[model samples]
Target: METRKLGDSDLEVSAIGFGGWGIGGAPFWSTEGDNASVKAIRKAVDLGINFFDTAPVYGFGHSEELLGKTLKPVRDRVILASKCGLRWSREALGAISKNASRTSIEEEIEASLRRLATDRIDLYMVHWPDVHTPQQETLETLVDIQRKGKIRHIGVSNYSIDQMKEASRYGKFISLQPEYNLLSRSIEAEVVPWCLANGVGIVAYSPLASGVLTGKYDKATRFKDWRSKGVIGTFQGEAYERNIDKVERLKALADSAGRTAGQLAINWVLRQPGVATALVGVKNERQIEENVSAAGWAPAPEIDARLNEVFARE
Candidate 1:
């Protein structure tokens, strides 16, 4: 429910933005149904969430369509965000690859517009860094479209400090969307500092450590989805076991504090400096309501410190 300026941009995004990945639901996640997803989005808005972030590859465009139609009536009141760069040869998740090329973006923007049923995207981002393409090409292309009014602001996701440095030389970005949470704080030492110094806001993704921080999984729980494929984040081997150990400690501490693990996780991410918003992917109305509640509250100082110690990786 708390709104903050995204980096240096004038766009006031909610502290808890609606992450559209889960609603898309396919190779990555399962969903109740399209009707449930639509209801979830509306529920988020009713609860004061105004920023919605999605990508073309999310359900291979299903997410955009659902968001486009569901939020059409309240378009002016909310901020719609979508990403390019990560493209797929087919509808399958395995076929997805990074392609931030000029031609690819030009083609992608048009398609996204059509699917989203909007003339301009509030925030357009490169989903991931395309090492093969020059940073200038991607940034300039975004700038060109910015001038043409296709996207209101430019952002980069899953980018490293070095990658951001290279990309910033060409054009300014208002935000950096990185994986930040209790179990994942790699950005704390560098990326967070860089964003604060450069005047870029941090939009954190996977704030719940992909549900591990929600206290629903254990060391024995093996994910059958993309988490097992080593695509992103820590989900296999001894590393996962260590993460689970920390999560267990976090769960106990969060429970004693009279808060759900998910709420605690989201609150911690929002408290971090340089973070403008924390994106929570919801699949139903209940989920959105819970996530939105995390926005206006915080744990006591002692509980917060205990949580930090529980999930500290460094």
Candidate 2:
């Protein structure tokens, strides 16, 4: 496994990070038992995955707990990242919303510290921007906390270019985690270039297009998980048919390249100029092993040219 620097920050993380959302379980995503999740995480560390990203909202903190249990033994050997600003109830499952206020950020940081069982967080990011709170105030608080040593570095997720610019005024943002993939590339037109100019590392989530680019779904395929059902709404009707058609073609292309569709997708993302890492969700050790195979390998220029042509026409 190779590593890359995160923007201008001193931290260097693995090219491929283990996403904690899937292991979170429950209404969020389809998951196996806690034991399986723990094994997968430990195996990830053994396989040289140094970056692990999670959020408190994932399984209402269960994901962090599991990660903490597995990684605590090798704490100094890994870079831990988690997000805040999305709060929910403990008694019942409800709509989780953003709260980037100073008070809210302070409270969430303490809770995350407790769940993660660590004194300092490597990269602490605002899971999403808060409309009610000003960006200046939120970032100022993050800077103060970083100075106090509760958080090592500050970053933002799901933030627009303007919002990131505003945040830079108050504090340093070394990375931006955005939903970017073959099917969802609107960010490349603006967000990606903006980050590249400002020295912000791109941490691409859902780089598999929520599994659609993995060649596992078809017109008759259906999802039962709430996260999949809600976030994958675009994968229906005409769009669904068109995407499936494109995937079939891409699969043929991948086979010609001696790769799987998922591996090809990951390779495409890593080849992008500003991308520092791609987060791939894993339910078991098999998924981690499969996703990591894309690392340390670069496809020829012609393959990428053909891929760009295939995706641009969509």
Candidate 3:
């Protein structure tokens, strides 16, 4: 496992971070059990994964709680990154919505701190941009909290270049968390360059394309999860079929490279410019082990070129 500096910050985070979405369980993703999930988190720490990313809305607080409880003993050895903005009243998928207003943020931070059981969060991010609230208001509130020593560093997730610039007008954010994988790379054209030019680190989520790049699912295989029809990326219809077709091609290249398709996909993400880390979701120890294998390695030149071509942005 290798470590990289997050943006221009002093924090050095693991290149492969543990994504806490799946461990939350129910309403979105299903986990084996609390015992299994806890073991997986501890296993991740054993394997040198120092960065853990979670959101308050994930399982309506379960993800943060589990992560808090599991990592409390080694809190000083790891970086805890969690998000705000998305809130929920009920533990249901439809109940969640973005609310990054000043008051909402003020409340969200306290709740996150309590749930995470952390005195100060290493990285506090806005899960999504709340169009209803002014960017100035949200960023200013985060700046105030950072000043208060509640949050160490500020960041944003799923934001466009313009939104990031507008938010930066009010406060500084060191990183941008985006849905980036071999299948989804719209950020390469402008966003990556923007981050590189401005010194903002990229934390790419869904590096497995919600499991599509794992080479396990095919055209006939259907998903029963939230990925059945995402508002974000392809997980349905002819577009999904097309993605599957490309993945089928990727599997061959991965075989030629002596790596599983999932590992190859994650390795590709890690090698991309401006990516400080690939936030991989793990439900158990086995899954995290494969994700960890993608790091500290590189594909042969020809295979790397073939991967880029197969998943080339349209």
Clash numbers, per candidate: 0, 0, 0
Candidate 1 residue-wise lDDT, 137-200, digit = tens? 9999999999999999999998888899999999989999998888888899988888999989
TM-score of each: 0.97, 0.96, 0.98
Ten contiguous residues minimizing lDDT sum, candidate 3: 223-232
Clashing pairs in 1: none
- Candidate 2: list runs displaced more than 4 Å: 90-94, 227-229
lDDT of 2 by residue, 185-240 (tens): 87887888899899899988988887888999998776666633555335667777
Clashes of 1: 0
The lDDT of each candidate is 0.90, 0.87, 0.92
How do these models rank on TM-score, best leading? 3, 1, 2
Candidate achieving higher lDDT, 1 or 2: 1
Number of the top candidate by lDDT?
3
Query: Who is ahead in TM-score, 2 or 3?
Result: 3
In candidate 1, how many Å is residue 110 off? 0.5
By lDDT, the candidates rank as 3, 1, 2
Ten contiguous residues with the weakest lDDT in model 2: 226-235
